[model samples]
Target chain A: MENKTEYKPFEVDQHLTAHGNYWAGKAGSRFFTSLRDKKKLLGSPCKACNKVFWPPRSVCTFCFGELKDMVEIGPLGTVETFTLVTYSEPIQPRTAPFIYAVIRLDGADTGMAHFLDEVEIGKVHIGMRVQPVFAKDRKGNILDIQYFKPL
Target chain B: MATKDKEWISIPMTVDVPYRFAAGGYMTKCLTELRDNGKIFAVECPKCKRVQLPPRVVCAECHVKNEKWVELPHEGTLMNFTIMYLPLTDPTTGKPHEPPFVYGSVRLDGATSVLDHMVEVEPDMDKVWVGMRCRLVLRPKEERIGDLSDIRYIEPLPGQKKPQTKSR
Candidate 1:
């Protein structure tokens, strides 16, 4: 055995690159397209159970029935839960110490996760009323709405 | 049925996942030696005595703990190689290594396993061949970042000539 002098364990840092295409099925397409084009929120209501999904799903998980009803949800929502991110990473959507929130849009039963900005983290709380801040240069993407601000 | 324009759409998105992997006890020892000392280390299986690089805890064949550590030389024989034409993504940086480069595996002397790395030679059959003697070129001590990238590339030793071929 050679001289075993140094004995510190180290972490190997790496960033992986993956490329692929996603086929957002029927309900998903309508949901995303509305965000991109109309700056409106759409939800798919399950025909059998009447459970509405914010990020619309094609079928109801509970009853396993087709969700055919496309209802206009909210450009306004309430903060269901949130966390303050104090750590920064190169791949994050925003800088460190930003607030990420799960918001339940008006008339929708479920919540969607997105960044919360334009309000102090200290001022954010559960059930806080918020509205979407639409970006002027909109593409057909969820980022069409930059972030949610206090209503 | 609705018109084609009424159909659902897809938006292209890129998801980036970054990670930090902990080099375990044996690997930490091996990589640290490579980073600080510019030396290669291997663990020999107690039962079979087969030396494995990137030292592991147990040998697959012998099913015993590998205890003996051996220092391997910098020069090795090229076991196999490939002339890559595609811009292969290097997972370490999430960037593509520019294409049409040569890379290969070299079995170091007295070591059972081979190390795979970029081969610094023209992507030609006459230039690179199996069984060629190559030496590991590492980044200078200051520039060494304690990773496999410390090895800049493997280069063929000087004065090696291409084997003469008979015309068909």
Candidate 2:
């Protein structure tokens, strides 16, 4: 003998919570300021350890020391690694195929991740030279250079 | 990631994220103006002498407050792009924006910056290019808010093989 049971669809709200004031570092005014201008300024480079910092910071990630100045970066660079994104959740417009890659700029010691354009995924390599294309007017932001393209 | 089966059913739903977000003092006022005027805004740093498309309250370079508000040219290049197979749900509308949408970083022409948002286009991966020029399409006035989403998506620019800018 087997027992039969009814399934009920329950409505619920997922209350995801975190502790304390965790400010989104990316949403800060300084970020928007430079991003609007099209300037790609990374976190201050640690003069002692030589680590290229993004989101310009007060201290170095490597030596735990102060970062002195904003470092201008990436008019040209190389592709470090990449992947073709085939899937994402259906929330916005969906495009099945695109490539995302990590790029190491010419002067900086670190790699920045962004989209790779003007080339097929099959043709993308680990060491392709790319450049930043700024918008007509500089807003002083990172998105000013839309993406690194094959140069 | 998992594949669905005959026994599995897909349910569409909406999510809402509401919170008081912070902006720089000068930018806060400028963004408030753009939201009122149905325009998008960004800022430039005087110290580093770089521009930010989203606008800012403080200079990322000198770690000081940047008081200047600068309007950006709507035209720009599609620096980077991605096609999402997954639907990024609109917390406000409580629905997905629709499948096969393009999202990208548009470096606005005049400002030294870029804006990231959804794009309305065919999700053809090969068709997307880094240097592709794009123009901004602003949202209706009533829908305006001092937020990044105020200006809609960026469309391809006209008659330019490469983005219009001096080669750095």
Best by DockQ: 1
Local accuracy of candidate 1 as per-residue lDDT tens digits, B1-168: 656777567666676677889998888888888888898889999888888987898999978878888999989999999999999887676578898999999888888999999999999989999989999999998888777779999999999987776889
Where model 1 places Cα greater than 4 Å from the true spot, the runs are A1-4, A7-11, A17-23, A73-137, A142-151, B1-4, B7-18, B93-96, B157-168
Candidate 2's error at A91, in angstroms?
29
Cα misplacement distance, residue B119 of candidate 1 (Å): 2.1
Q: State model 1's lDDT.
A: 0.87
For all candidates, state DockQ relative to the true structure. 0.43, 0.01
Where's the lowest-lDDT run of ten residues in candidate 1 chain A?
A1-10
Candidate 2 lDDT, A108-140, residue by residue in tens: 777878777788888899998887666667544
Question: How accurate is chain B of model 2, given as a TM-score from 0 to 1?
Answer: 0.73
Which segments of model 2 are wrong by more than 4 Å?
A: A1-151, B1-18, B22-24, B160-168
How far in Å is the alpha carbon of B125 misplaced in model 1?
Answer: 1.1
Global lDDT of each candidate: 0.87, 0.64
Q: Give model 2's DockQ, 2 decimals.
A: 0.01
